[model samples]
Target: MKKESKNIKKNKIVDQFEFDEFQKWKIEKEKERIKTHVPTIYGYARVSTEEQHLEPQIKQLKNSGAKKIYQEKWTGTTTKRPIFEKLISLLLSGDTLMVTKLDRFARNTQEALTTVEDLNKRGIKINILNMGYFDDSPNGKLMFTMFSAFAQFEHDLIVSRTQEGKAYAKKYDPHYKDGRPKKFTEEQVELAWELRKQGNTYKMINRKTGISIKTLQRRFNELKLKDSE
Candidate 1:
């Protein structure tokens, strides 16, 4: 009877020890799983023109421990940017997206706010390098809101200045045009009209005169003779 009791106690102790070891192993496995599932950081950069520098933005992102980087040369006013779309597609929940500056990501407040809100909805974080904080925090949210307001204000100011300038220009230079200057010179316009009189296609005139087909057509329209009364 005594021997049986001792064997029973020993078995219970062995079972408990095995159960504790298994629990420890399970906890370690859970930690390893969490570590592996953590998301990576991605960086994005953009320059409006070829003359602008991109190296500084790239270097800043690298220093921030960005694992991936996407870049493009395009104006910020358009939402049809290739790399920007690519970055959006690559983001996943818990991922961090970093940019060197606000204007680097978007030229206007509405676009910037929309982008940030979209990322937030996906459980992704956005880090603006100059702001010195991640966008997921309360303070960061306030700061972003303020900054966006300022950006909108600045855009409004720019528009106002542009309108004032255009008004002044119109008063002074009646022929001032807002966009690209006409490609066809006065001589080219005359030649285009002469070619059109000889039945030359706009394409042929474009190839011959190095003027765009649209410009050639416009020149032809400008020289169309009125029908005799």
Candidate 2:
């Protein structure tokens, strides 16, 4: 007799306030008074670049009772965060927003102030881990303002250091390339030109060297015209 094996599947209930750690903590503290209608806690996490990571922030947010999370890998120099924007649109009154840090939420001082102001007006509670909750109270507003200023200063310093490092590299390292490194080398370009001169079509050269036809044509023209393109 052939025996059939059964596949086991795991299903965990989604955290919806009552199932969350922070909410559970609150419930434990005030078991007699804790209500079932707690506000939803949403987490927004962001890293400045693609090279950066989001796990640590997410872990903290989950531990802090965030039922749902939105994350983004993008530059913080601009106020255009698509994920954050979407999160904001979904938030209603009496909801709580959680951030691992203040800088991950806002880029500049003005942006930070305006965003927090709007959230405060909407009766949303913002919990910044490094700093405490942001509120409409005088002290809370002051703290947020200070944190926003520091974040802006840090961003400025980073930009200054990056530019200075680039300038120094250009002055000292003759082989240093600015911006992203070149995909194809000068030797490759010369070989491509040779292939072109031998009546090889752009498509043929591209197939052989794994370079795009547009790139091969551009390099061939640049080599022939002696241009710095």
lDDT of 2 by residue, 1-229 (tens): 1222222111133334336977778667655433434678999999988988899999999999999999999886665889999999767778999999888878788888888999999999999988878999999889888889988898899899999999999999999988987689999988888888899988889889988988887777878788564
After TM-score superposition, what is the CA distance of residue 156 in candidate 1 from its true location, in Å? Answer: 1.4
TM match of model 2 to true structure:
0.65
The lDDT, on a scale of 0 to 1, for candidate 2 is 0.85
Question: What local lDDT does model 1 show for residue 73?
Answer: 91
lDDT string for model 1 (130-229, tens) is 8755465688668887887787788789889999999899889989988768655788788777887898988888878888887776656666643232
| Runs in model 2 lying further than 4 Å from the true structure | 1-38, 183-229
* Clashes per candidate (backbone, < 3 Å): 0, 0
TM-score of each: 0.59, 0.65
**Candidate 2 — which pairs collide?**
none
Question: Model 1: clashing residue pairs?
Answer: none
